[model samples]
Target: MKKIILSLIVFGATISLASAQILPAFQIGLKAGTNLSSLNSTASETFSGSNRAGYLVGVWTRFGAVGFNFQPEMYLTSKNVDVTSSSGGVTRAKFTSIDVPLLFGGKFGALGLGGRFYTGPVVSFAIDKNQSFDSAAGKVFSLNYQDQNFAWQFGTGLDIKRISVDLRYEAGITKQTYDGRQTRISLFNLSLAYSLVKL
Candidate 1:
């Protein structure tokens, strides 16, 4: 019993020391953004759709010191898209999902202001029972059920003191179309984040 307790205590101390050496600072922040999204068709078919606007609100946490950082964020995002069929009918779809992103970044510059570039993978899970098809016209449409999606995002930002502004682009890797057709989500995001707590 004594040997086991000593080993556990030593292991915990080693882990704490390693963390203190590698990551000296931590921050928690709030972020809000606008999403300009479109439903894009695969090469085999043609899709007629217009870009739709949506909003995102989230909480994010960052760890590490000056040059390198790792961030994880959770967001409530509105994913809206417009689609038009060959029969001249339009259907608007609205999907609400929870998004989690793990980002690795590099920060540079001096003084109280700096610049950062980041890239990450995002996983999104749908919260609704079915993919809601709102307001449709022309022909009857069958909506695809996409409960989860995977995407990648890359962006650059300006970080000033406790706040940051970012411009990012995201591309969906998983196709979310029914009827043997391929479709994906693509979007541009502009966001502002404020650090609420620093440790």
Candidate 2:
């Protein structure tokens, strides 16, 4: 956790420095929302449908001419997934990650009527994991695990004044499981952020 804290501090300092240099509109924000997450595999087993509650808090700096700006942010996120068997059983999995995203987009109108598009990569560190299984025999089992992988996020959002809403798709690029099994996990996040300051 020390490394994550340090990285956040460094990222904050960098944003501060960039704001001082460019004198652009800088804003720090907090966002909280839900994530719809699931895992997809090439192997023909059907996956389960589960919804996870996730949130993010970050600092962002926007710079450039009117109608176009570049924004970068660092945030902490939580993701969850629950899988059920076709015959009616359930397994739950959860993950927490710290992510940094660099986004580029623009504003449309003075009243925040237009739409903005942004896409970027996210670097994440998994902090926790939990798995639970429900059997047909009325028995339950739980497992504790950890996943540390470098992931990627690319998606778009809409910015209106101090409030920005975003929908992002995230995918894991690194394999987290053993047994030489390669699996891919993906999620869709609907988030709302409030800008805190303008520099």
TM-score for each candidate, following the candidate numbering? 0.81, 0.69
Clashing pairs in 2: none
The C-alpha RMSD in Å for every predicted model, in order, reads 9.2, 13.0
Candidate 1 C-alpha lDDT tens digits along 57-151 = 99999887746889899999887776766655556777788989899997776555878889999999988633334435456355473789899
**Pairs of colliding residues, candidate 1:** none
Instruction: Compare the candidates by TM-score and give the number of the best one.
Output: 1
For residues 1-199, could you state the per-residue lDDT of candidate 2 as single tens digits?
9999999999998776554333345567777667776666553253344666666665566675545677777777777766554445676767777767677765454444446666666667676666767777343323222455555676667767688788888776665431233456677888888877754
lDDT per prediction? 0.79, 0.63
> What C-alpha lDDT, on a 0 to 100 scale, does residue 24 get in candidate 2?
44
Q: Model 1 RMSD to the real structure?
A: 9.2
